[model samples]
Target: MTTIGDFMLGGHAACDDLFAQAENAAGDWPRAEGALGVFRDTLLEHIAMEEEVLFPAFEDESGAAQGGPSETMRAEHQQMRALLEQMADAARAHDERRYLGAADTLLMLMQQHNMKEESMMYPMIEAAAGTRADELIAQCRAIELRSAGTCTCSRHGAATA
Candidate 1:
């Protein structure tokens, strides 16, 4: 059984790896540009899966529709997006110092945000949603970001890279 926490924790690790790759390439504008773009897109896609699929389902199941952890998470997501934009701008200007500063801030924020989600939000979602948790997670996994060229899941008869 693929628990919600398991899936989301894996996603957090994947995003972290991508972020590190971008950070490592910060001194090289050519490499940093491409690496950062991938990180940004992948992180955005992760946020979309939570906001569009998991969070909504958890909200409905838990009946905290107006305000709750989901709202808090969404706000943090916005903050992360803003930081990503800053990083992009700094990269475009070829300012490694400014880029690293934003990356540092973003890395700290992401660590905290992911901790809250993994330790509290995801577990709460699993407990509240029960059997439906599986469905919600499946929906999240099924989401293909706009930047993702082709479907890689076996259900679509596409080869996974």
Candidate 2:
């Protein structure tokens, strides 16, 4: 069903979608500012998901060296936050060069981050979460949607998409 891995995967895809939209707009998007806001909100929410829940779960489960994946992911998230701040500033200034460069950097970082979670961390979380895995995943899914304003993030009633 909805494991943290799956939830995070969807979020990564959403980030990619926002990135793609921004790239298509390039130096001419009248709404580039709003678009960047959406991207920032979505990215921040995704990072928060990992920082608040998934990373801890994985840390407790796998126990990789030096806290392992969770540790690395945290550092990456911090790096990403910095990049996002820079990108946001560039967008606000309408600096095409800076925005595009930051976009390229973010795209590479995001793809790599997605790969790490999908390939390494997710499986561990799945096994570790066990019977509660479904419940936790459900919570994550709700958060994703709520962050999107599509619905509430509570484990009440059936989820749509």
Candidate 3:
């Protein structure tokens, strides 16, 4: 049975691939910029899935909004967002060095962030959400589809409706 952990990990894998694509295209400004755009879009969708759907459901189910792990994750998301903007700017300017710097930082941040979510937050969410976990996953999938403007339902291979 597919679980929330599976879905979240799938996102992590996708982000990793996108980031690699951007890195591979670093020598070509136009290609790099295009890759970064797709990476940024995909990353934003992943963030929205957590911030808009998963986190709320977890908070509601666990009642840990005041000072919880979700709050920590949200704070990290903000940091990542800042880095994303900087990376985007660097890409636009065709500053490979600057983009690489920001990409390095973002990659480390994502590594740490993904670790927490995969090991701790997602399990907590799964247990707390119980029978509603599938519903929350569907909502996340919907957000992903909307943000990406494509049917990524095959990625998770899970029921989306």
| Per-residue lDDT of model 3, residues 3-119, tens digit only | 999998998999999999887787698988878877877788899999999999999988999889999999999999999898888888888898899999999999999999999
Q: Against the unseen true structure, what C-alpha lDDT does each candidate score?
A: 0.85, 0.73, 0.87
* Model 2: worst 10 consecutive residues (lDDT sum): 151-160
What are the TM-scores, per candidate, against the unseen true structure?
A: 0.90, 0.82, 0.90
Residue pairs with backbone atoms closer than 3 Å in model 2 (clashes): none
> Which runs in model 1 stand beyond 4 Å of their true positions?
145-147, 150-161
lDDT of 1 by residue, 117-146 (tens): 999999988888888877887687677434
| Clash count per candidate | 0, 0, 0
RMSD list, candidates in order: 3.3, 4.2, 3.3
lDDT of 2 at 66: 85
Output the better candidate (1/2) by TM-score.
1
Flag clash pairs in model 1. Answer: none
**What TM-score quantifies how close candidate 3 is to the native fold?**
0.90
Which lDDT value does model 3 have at 62? 86
How would you order the candidates by TM-score, starting with the best? 3, 1, 2
TM-score of 2: 0.82
**Model 3, stretches more than 4 Å misplaced?**
150-161
Which whole-number lDDT from 0 to 100 does residue 12 have in model 3? Answer: 93
